[model samples]
Target chain A: AQTVTQSQPEMSVQEAETVTLSCTYDTSENNYYLFWYKQPPSRQMILVIRQEAYKQQNATENRFSVNFQKAAKSFSLKISDSQLGDTAMYFCAFMKGTGANSKLTFGKGITLSVRP
Target chain B: DVKVTQSSRYLVKRTGEKVFLECVQDMDHENMFWYRQDPGLGLRLIYFSYDVKMKEKGDIPEGYSVSREKKERFSLILESASTNQTSMYLCASRRWYEQYFGPGTRLTVT
Candidate 1:
């Protein structure tokens, strides 16, 4: 079974500043994918960024990027130029790369507070 | 844009009542999943369907059941609702590994 862990329960960042949220996972499978999903006050889960285990280069999506270290089993999300809209609960997820990949295993989640 | 829609944004039901939560995806995703979210605990999968009429039990499926009569819709059911079941329920559609989630339904079991 694959499990994702987000050590930080809560974090705060000043607007326009950068913040990094840590995530680690345990999986015996070699091929997998990591993801970060944000749930704002509206409770809509939005995909932030995703990284494939096979990709050596990290994934970047404008303001959101991931520091994916496959050897260390670490996938951290970095948010640059953070804004107030970034204040939300962020979840780290893990999924195996297979046709039978059942569902995503999520971390406990971290509450990010973007202070003005 | 891919959209996953849940039937209700908020619902309140009594104990021992049968609760049904419906989810539909606009995109023709092959896989659909149901998950429950609680404070501190992230999203835990309850059930999932790969194709129409095909289902699988996820991490926590004891008190839950599911239906997939159509390709785009998936339903999560609670045989007997309990106070512990009061939480936010989410639905998702998947193509490969990455999935698109719905707005979620806040279910309150009294």
Candidate 2:
């Protein structure tokens, strides 16, 4: 079984500033994938970014990026130039690299409020 | 772009009542999933289907059942709704590793 942990329950960031949401996971699988999802007030959860365990380089999607330390089993999301639109509940998820039956295990999630 | 749609945005039901939550996807994705979201719990998977007539229990499948008679539609059912079942229900369809989600249904069981 796999478990994801996001210790922070809530965070606040100033607009145009940067913020990092920390996440860690416990998994025995060697090959897997990590993801960050954002759910805004609209209640639509969208994928922010993704990182593969085999890749050394982190994933970046515009203002969103991740610091993936595979050895430490830590994946943190960094939001640069945070905006009001970034205010949402963010979740970290893990999935095995192989097998069609593989499912995602998600962290408790952190509520981020970007204040203007 | 993939689009997933839930039958309702909000619903209220009484205890012991049978509840049905419908989900439909426009894209021809092979896999669909049902998840429940609660405060501080993020999202917990209830059930998933890889194909028509094939269903798999997820992490939290207790008190929940799913039906996938068609490729684009998946339904979640509560045999007898309880107060604890009041939460947000999310429906998603997978395209490879990426899963696209619907707006979600806020179910309140009283």
Candidate 3:
């Protein structure tokens, strides 16, 4: 069985600052994928960034990036230049590399608050 | 961009009533998933459909059922609505690699 854990239940960051949300997972599978998702007040879950197990370099998308330590099963998301719009629920997810049989396992999200 | 749509944004039902939550995708994705989001627990997969007429039981599938008659549409069914079943239901469609989610349906049972 695979499980994802988000240690921080809540976090706060000032505008134009940076914040890091921690995530760890337990999986025995060799090939897998990790992801970060943002759910705004609109109730929509949007993909933020994704990292593949085979890749050693972390994934980056604009102001968001990930520090994926595959050996330690850690995949943390970093938000740079935070804005008020970044206030939302952030969830970390995991899935095996299998094509059709892949099912996402998510952690108990962390609520991010961006203050002015 | 991929777009997933759910039938309702909010739904209310009685304890013994049957509930149906519909989800449709416009990108013709091969995989559709149904997940439930609780406060302390992020999201748990209830069911997943890889193709038309092909369904798989996810981690939590105790009181849920699913139908995938068409490639682009997937439906989640609750045989008996209960208060414990009241949660945010999310639909997602996966293609190539990333999964696109729909604006969840918040269902409450009384």
lDDT tens digits, residues B42-73, model 3? 89899999999999999899999999999999
First chain TM-score for all predictions: 0.96, 0.97, 0.97
| TM-score for each model | 0.97, 0.98, 0.97
Candidate 1 clashes between residue pairs 3 or more apart in a chain or in different chains: none
lDDT by residue for model 2 (B32-107), tens: 9999999988899999998898999998999999999999999999999999999999999986788899999999
What's the ranking of the predictions by DockQ, best on top? Answer: 3, 1, 2
Per-residue alpha-carbon lDDT of model 3 for A1-116, expressed as tens digits? Answer: 99999998999999999999999999999999999999987768999999989999999999999999988999999999999999999999998885988888899999999999
**Candidate 2 backbone collisions, by pair:** none
Give the TM-score, chain B only, in order for the candidates: 0.97, 0.98, 0.98
**Whole-model lDDT per candidate:** 0.92, 0.94, 0.94
Task: List the pairs of residues colliding in candidate 3.
Answer: none
Candidate 1 chain B weakest ten by summed lDDT:
B94-103
